[model samples]
Target: MAKLKLTAGRVRAFTCPADKPQAFLWDADVNGLAVRATLGAKAYIYQGRLNGKSLRVTIGDVNVWSLEEYREPKTGKVITPGARPEARRLQALIDQGRDPREVKAEVTAADIAKREKTKQANTPALEAWQAYIKARASKWSERHKADHETMSREGGQKIKRGRREGMPDKKEPGILRPLLELPLSSITRDAVAGWLEQQAYRPTRARLAVSLLGTFLNWCSDRPEYRDQVNPDACTRMKKDLPKPQAKDDCLQREQVKLWFHHVQRISNPIQATYLQCLLLTGARRNEMAALQWEDVDLTWNTLKIRDKVEGERIIPLTPYVKSLIDGLKPARVVLLHSDDALKRSPFVFASATSTSGHITEPRIAHNQALKNAGLPALSLHGLRRSFGTLAEWVECPAGVVAQIMGHKPTAIAEKHYRRRSIDLLRVWHVKIESWILEQAGIEQQKEETLKLKKSTAA
Candidate 1:
């Protein structure tokens, strides 16, 4: 091997022979340090003996690295600038009977681990929340999925309607947005408690947010990537600070039914008005009814296939008035010469043109307005469903019949194991209940015998 003191000019001028793949110019000062040259590139390299075997390692490209040492201005520390110091360090490791290759591998692995740790430490809770939603979304109902999204949504979007005169046009941030904006590792118990305190004004929503947060933390702990980043016990003991949830009992009385019907029927949007009526009559949940499609209704069979939360789906009788309301909403089929020119109909039953969701979404404003006009205290949409179950007692309907109609899970062995009534059998008690409620509400209902005769005639 040839040896010479390496300089910037000499290192840059070094080249390999045309027939050779690579050539090296050894440094006289540093035994292992050399400038290696190939057809396309030049780099500083080191060659040393480790455990009596020859070893080689590339230090850096000659274009990017300096051949002389200097002081770092920021830290005021001596900085080793070139491949010479690196070669000396590797020679010291060789003196210690350590392979320089193994040392480099260990340092590279440590750098990677440090980078990963820093990345995970700075990862936002919102990222984990999104991953959790995506992982679990397939199993969740549309309403349940919406609830999770609503909690963590970043607000400031322009409002379409219902902005008060003096209020800002942009909407407020979601209840969980502030907390979820923080890094996942920073979501400690104290942090969660502070968030809960900030959201104390809306206890109902705050409680729901905490419950969701707890579930999310549990999921993070179970995942290998997120396990070390999350504090699973962050939500534990949080309920002590939170207010206990009050059970709602807002069912309509028999006498109030007339007033409720009168005001609700006067609503300007017929789709909303009919939806409110169907909600009360069928005893189905608010979301279950809102998600109703045109295909779910069967006027010929007088059956409504309700998408059940307990079961996958449950078949219930589409009572006369409910059937009539749904019938009125159907688009008229026009005779068309060209199929493409014909109007495309919406799949949702209670269709809305303005909503992103094809069907009606927020009917509470209209419902609340009607409640105010009728001089009724306040009735939630669920109250209307509850009213159906309560009012079913008027006609002495059996518990099992009402439970099946309302899509309630059977509480007893007999109801769960032995009671699977046909849709026709359910219709018998269902129509009777619907008639009694309508009669109480000052609405005249056709007799069951007349309805049966009409069905037979139509058939």
Candidate 2:
């Protein structure tokens, strides 16, 4: 290294020393400021020592970066006009016992830290939701998984033809879709409040969406990467503003069951008709009845093993009339009744030809038509299950026995832990309940005829 009055001309003329690969020409005007001349390019360099360690840093170049016209804030005038003005600032830092290289590194580190935070803040909520779902898909049922997908669905385009000719295309994105694209950090309580207000017209759906969103946020917070990016309790703050879910009581009264059954039997689709009647007789959830598999049903045992949400699976007694109804639906009927090509020898007792699941997805349209025909008030399919529970009280059926048959969890300690009733014991109450329900519906016990029919059908 040699001390030189480094000027534009001198800096340009500087070259690598013949004896060495490179050389440094220190500026005589500014200590520790030098021009580094390598084999090809020339650049400004700052040199200093911190804690007995030598520190050397490249300031910039002669042309691309040089003396920027920076006015002193207090003086409002220029003080330095030489090349590599930043070199002088580095020298001042070196004099203050701070390594310019380390300070540069610290500033660089801070910039990186700020960028990482910004990136996390900009992470899309839907992207996070997908990840959350992926992590949890194994634990969730198909219906549960479908609900999450439905919540984030971009609805299909409106059909221009047929019955839905003028209705707005349901293809619009779901309520959660807008929130899904937003950064997790942006889902504030105020944001949720605005969304809730928009959804006030459909209070029930709005409440469910809020609950799901809360679960999603909680999932986000539990993960290390997104913990700082989301507020898990964000949905909780909006709960007070949400409309309370109105309790549903649209079940068939004792008198209505007969008409309901009469209208249901008149439905052209035998499988749909049978499915509705099964819902009433069994007190099973709609999906549970729809998903009945051949393997789970045993005519000999008179037990229908139903996949239940609360109990995992429940064995309900296949009473005489129910046995008659199910036995009549032979393999030929299963094939002939299904209109959809997709349903070919499916094991589901109530298989559908057109459904994606090869089983009835929903029978609301058929059910509604039947209700209209019956001239009865509208009732949800779940109302049938509720009706079963309500009507069983007329026979003085024990609440626990009814709960067991319905796959409801035991509320009392004795029922949950101590009183594990056998299938035979369950059958006693279940058969009695079915007989009582049939009597109320004005149906005779056609046991002999059903048995004779089954034998003839088998032959």
Candidate 3:
């Protein structure tokens, strides 16, 4: 062994090269031990010798650990040479004449850890997840934003409705409420595990809640920040530790959809009726379609520029039925319909009278009423969007093309960044989708049906 040079950088130069596989020896200068970098890289480690054995510790990157930056693992504070805690421990071990084999073993494990980290090479999970999200930053929106952020943003933590509420409402959205406020890093896997442990007995919600959290965090692991730091144990092997809950079998029956549409047509609020019809026809999100304006609709061209598109403005094909629905709106309401305060200032297509500018904060009561009138289950207005996806798949719409209409980021590997703007294909999807829903709803265009019904009532 060479005499200690007494400088941090020069420490590496004095150490002997490995004579055998995975050798461990103290650096003579500072007695901070050194080890080879992992994955054939220039990384090395600093080991602390205490009690006649080395306590393995991470110094820093091979060339990057400055004298000023050198640290002790226990206190996480800087240490000067000769006064290094590990060196003091080694002196104590020497005085006792007891070999620090246990300490050496710990150092060996620490060295292997340093090498293993080098092998990962790429950015951490949190980093990668953030970058992935940022890359598709344009695709995110409050209407459809939760799907992407559900994981890192604590989308998994489910809050139960109080025994009194029975269901989520405007003041509280039930189990989904609290997690939305927290970031991924703030909650530890232990914290999540503890949360899951509390709810584990409630198999269905427990699985969904934990799975959502796990999947999101798992995705985070692919990124750089959490890859090494976040634990996999919390989410993985869920089926083994806690069984998964059975998922709901969704989709309204054709008769149910027909019954629902009939009631939808009679809902006193014409705009709500029209918005519901549009939902059936276009399968767009409520706000995305609700925020439509007369300008976005081109009666002459028979198309609606779906401005509420999650990604950006997209031109949705307006079918004859969709056109009829729009064309038939009473002229008196058109002014209010497009006015910012028409629906209490909501600017929503289904704006309530209470909202300003036709804008609505939420449509909970109205939507539920419509659903109940249609005699449908407790499905969400959002579920209608899912129905559209299912039906589109049923009708054999090309996966890529349907994804485009849904405003989803394309999954086709070669089609990821494709910006196709042709309306020819979209027209086909719009028509097929409309036919499917209208067929389910039993809505047939009766030219004077509106008149005949009015006359019968008047008579």
**Top TM-score prediction, candidate number:** 1
For residue 269, what is the lDDT in candidate 2? 82
How well does each candidate superpose onto the true structure, as a TM-score? 0.85, 0.75, 0.47
The TM-score of candidate 2 is 0.75
Deviation (Å) of 192 in candidate 2: 4.4
Clash totals in order = 0, 4, 45
- lDDT per residue as tens, model 1, 1-459: 889999878987899999999999999999989989999999988898876789898888887777766679999687656677778888999999998889989999999988988987887789889999999999898778988998898998998765545889998888889889899889999899888888777778888888889999999999988888899999997877877777789999998988888888889988899999999999999888988987998878889889998898999998888887888787621222223454557777887665666677889889989999989998889998999999999999999999999999899999989887988889999989988887777775665523211111212
Q: Where does model 2 exceed 4 Å of error?
A: 13-26, 36-42, 67-83, 91-102, 115-173, 176-198, 213-243, 266-270, 324-347, 439-445, 448-459
Tell me the RMSD of model 3 versus the true structure.
15.2
Q: What are the lDDT figures for the candidates, one per model? A: 0.85, 0.79, 0.58
lDDT for model 3? 0.58
* Backbone steric clashes in candidate 2, count: 4
Which should have the higher lDDT, number 1 or number 2?
A: 1
